[model samples]
Target chain A: MRFGNKDLARYPFLREALSYVTKNEFKIEDLDNSEFYHLVEKAKRKIEDYVFEGKLAYQIDYNKTHEIIVQEEVIIFLISLLLIKSISIDSVTKKFALFESMRFERYLISDLDNSNQDDKTVKLILYKIFEDLFQTKVDLEVDIFNFYKIKISDYLDHPIAFQEREWNLVNRTVDKGYVYLDGSEIVRLFRNELYLLIIDRIKKMNPEVLPDMIISISDSLKSRWEKMYPPLRAPGHQDILPPCIQHIYNQIDKGENLSHPARVLLGTFLIYTNKSMEEMIDLFKRLPDYNEQITRYQLEHLAGKRGNTKQYFVPSCEKIKLNNLCFETVVCKGISNPTQLIYRKSSK
Target chain B: MTSPTTSSHTSSSSDKLKDSITDSFNYPHSVEDDPNKIWLEKVFRKHYFNSSSEIELDNYVSEHEFGFRLFDGYIRRHLNFKNKRELIASIIKFSPSDIFCSPARYQHPSASMDQKGWIGADLIFDIDGKDLQLDCARIHNMTFCKNCKLIEKEVHTSCSKCNSSMVQIVELPCQNCIRNLKKEVTKLVEVLHDDFGIENNSINIFFSGNNGFHIHVVDESFFNLSSMKRSSLTQYLLGRGYLVDNLGFRIDKSDNITMLPNKIYYNKGWRARLLSRLHLQLKNHRIDDKFMRKITQIKETNKIGISGVINNQIQNISVKIDPNVTIDIHRIFRLAGTINSKSGLVKSRVNNLTTFDPFKESCIREDALVKLDAFVDTKLFFNGTSYKIKTGINNIPEFVAVYIISKGIGDIYIEKLK
Candidate 1:
């Protein structure tokens, strides 16, 4: 399954697209030059749209032949990555990754849904991605539920945040090491991989490499980002956290090893108090054994950010006692749940 | 023969070893021991010296964390040996009550658990006879309540007098229960082989030196399975957590579940297993034509439907392995060829399940005559040989004496003779 120049523009994250860009010798100097002025504007617009709307901003126009910029898309994506890296803010980088992967997810699904058995290229690309790229074995007979059989190892490594019993490996019909999933679900899995791939290129860059066009675009992005996005940690509510939760929070703050149940208590407590994804990631990164991969999987699962989409509630005082996690204080006497502790403390 | 003085003082002495590196203590002297434990130690010492070849240590032996439980109930852990001879030497030196080794390979085998860089571990499923809940256990097992001090067959959940469930069950599981445990192991092997695609040769089963068995999947593919994946494997074998919705069943708009009976494929996964179970139920005439008609005809009623039959099938599910043992990757399993403290029998490897008798084959010590004070009326039945030994002084085989003494059902008769 070979990709054409138009397909390359659509999936610049693919190895073939990167090779095409490298083979054409797309240079960094072209971003600041008149010869690639078409791409420079598009790259800046990509970063600007990412910081503000968290959306990808490019589309192909096959009908309008004069406006076709198929050859410049990969170069624009690379320059956009350079601009993001020059910005060097972690939150902005994460936002860029999330948007790009989501956009890819949207595009990939539309492409697959539009294609049929006669479209030999889609079937070939399915094998090319599963067999060649991810090395995942696949049998693509879309069943009654639009599900296809995939290998268990590949299924286990799926990057999508799913906590539903339906998503559980045991709950699915696993036959001879194969799990079932739909095309959209499969795209969701690789979309996360594409996210991490983009993130790797976005971390820790020399703002020294910023061109005039990139610098102007980044300045606008930074100002807009500072105005729009809230700080990862919201002020207040820390003191009002239940004693049991506070104990765990303090333990993590000091880079101590809290037990699994204790971490769950603290995680659910923070998530329950309207702490966003970035805030939770910020809070958990302070732990001694914090592995970003593991923490993200668990935190997203608890937040119900993915499958089943059922958010976890903080354990009540009675339930907390069953796990032996309760540290009752005189101020917490009447409160039955941890979420109530905020009002309990503020009332005093 | 051990001196009468040493045998008498076995349970009296305190631990005298101060050093941690050596981890050795005088067997008949300062380290307090049980008489049954001392006898078992003597048997193990001879067995390791003679039958060390049979005790196969897991590969990369230097990277395995070995541990030993002493007669005084002290566990010496985080020990490593370079070769098989060194392990045997330690076994012969310590005369430990039981032997154990980690299934995991570590960078620093002697380091603390967190410090031990765990590379991988074999997937093991432990099937203890007590967990099987076989009816035969009531005939041979005994339960002693902590509060009321009542001793009887293991048929009570709560003490009649104290009403407290603070009871300890002493299980000398008979041949019947052991046979049931073997059947469970067979089921587990089949499930691992067929459903999970684990080869039969890659799966090794060991009698747990007691009334149980341990299955180890030694294949390289499974060595690096995470705790989550291992947990799923356990669930699959036990027939729990299956999604009937994925297999052509759905809750109807009117509330009752609607299932496509025509779509039930009798060739793959849970559908195949469930249909086979239904076939058995049909053969027994328990599931009549009316019930079959009711199942295929159910659409939109408030009445409870096919869920009852499915729930019944799930209840009488497949494998009966202890889930905790499989899920925990860091667990130290009993090393094969080591004597189990529960019954003074070796954890021997089994070849033929039909003829393998734990009481007979796992008995490594010479069958010498020994007198014992039997504590209860217990039956020792295997291979058409049955002994319904009653309370008070009785003569029995040395192997039988060690078992009965270790199980807390009998005592060595030397003290009574004196």
Candidate 2:
């Protein structure tokens, strides 16, 4: 069950990996040294890549990948986590978790490649990991996709966590308290568990003691992020908005304080629907924390009339969902954006 | 599930039933004044005392909690027994209106829910006739007014004699509901054996006293499964929440076009069952095997839609078993061979499902002829005897009388000593 240091780097989130990486107690001051700068920069670059490319470009050299690279990768994840926490955007953090989990799974699945490890060795490792992580019983059923027969209870114990009808228990082959599944299903299930594990580590991290260098870098990245995607004005067509947007509008109308992303989603959606600055600001009037000047500035920024005038498109449905904003009304099913919600309702 | 007002049930009867009764009683309307409850208590006490047959006690009876609803009293629970003798002792002591046993075996069976050290529970599937909406209910059910004692042959907003909302709807499940429920059970049992790999012997089917059936899967494999796992099992038999995404089938949502698969991975699971049914539907046409590849699952001519056809197929294959019954680990399930006080009928084990007839098989089997007032006109075939019951006093055997009275559609006709 003991994972080598090289394997630990690939799965730094593993319980065994915690012992190797956390050997020395850390302080905020430790992150400032030149020696740690490369790690911090590498960590920042990973986030930048994920935010822009929508992928984590991480690779594991199964053989001859240096122990130093291993140690570095392990420590970099911790640094990357802190950077994400310091940046403090839920959308970025959530998406990064998904990408990072998939990246980790890619290597974990790669380790089971028959060309790299003998059949016996592959099974021993796979069994150990399965038992260690999920307390599941698995037997290799077919060669391709590392197909295995996993006990039904193990698969169904948290099957709903998948949230997809495909992962529903009714759809799978279950016999003698076991479910037959391919490597991808097993790998994705692992990714879901790992995502939770990573989120937990990220939650425990204190962004308050963040070093000045990390904070400055995060601020610059955040601005670059703001300019990366832009918004613009649209025709003021309808009085009503999509339910998701309407829900937020209603909340603001009732003087409820909108969360940062909630405000962003609402503002951009309003601009796309062609709400004027005065009209948009008027909706914000009942907010408990409402101030006319600040509201005007925020709405103006959203309308792309403020600094760095690269107009932002209304936030995509994916982004809204990641930020937990979309109401996902049935009428707006295929419409990918909130502005489309207007067109959809109008067409109907 | 529908609009606020209850669905209608109508009554049909002949006044000839009134002259037939010499003695009478009513329940559910006035529980304190119910002599029927007293008669039922006597019936249950006599059955348990005389029947020396083995009471079907679940594994670890000492660790199982028991609950009982005593005649004319509130339900009592948190009681445990050491053996069948002790359980029977308690039953005789109470002469309970209903009996229930916990599916879960706990370390401290009598302890509070939180404190009860839960061990494991048998997987159960409850399929109730009441849960099923049958077209035949109108044929066999009626609405009876407790105030005016008026029986309406059909659903009425109010009684004809008095405008009373204090009315009860009663049902005598026709052959259609029974046949439908039996089909559900058959489908469930097949899935348990073929899909779950549970042995046929371990799957015990029981007539759930009244208008339902309780299936207890006593297999050791499922005993340790958590509620979530059991819920998954329920979903499997229920044939729901199956998305074609993982099944290698794709439907373009925007255009509503489905990319039908020529070769479905139908070797096992739901797809296997689907393929079998699809085979039967396509068997008559020889063009199926040739054009089956061509027409495997393409868009049906536009109107009804592909989703509709696929959905109909899925619904046809789905078994109607209650997920709550299986998922609830702490449920107090009714025991077989025990009376469901609601209907005064024993929840007997179905040894041979096809031959199992509840009306003929389930009863107190006493020789006494009891006179009862029929609140509704209904037909009954009991112990090889058939009666076209009318809405009036009628003389019937003790078994049929108890069964009807417990159903809230009849009351004992008490002879006034004039």
Q: Assess each model's interface with DockQ, reporting 2 decimals per model.
A: 0.30, 0.39
Q: What is the TM-score of chain B in candidate 1?
A: 0.83
- Give per-model TM-scores: 0.75, 0.73
Mark the 10 consecutive residues where model 1 chain A has the least summed lDDT: A61-70
Error of 2 at A122 (Å): 5.1
Best by TM-score: 1
Taken over the whole model, the C-alpha lDDT of each candidate is 0.68, 0.69
Winner by DockQ: 2
Q: How far off is residue B20 in model 1, in Å?
A: 4.0
lDDT of 2 at A130: 69
Name the weakest run of 10 consecutive residues (lDDT summed) in model 2 chain B. Answer: B1-10
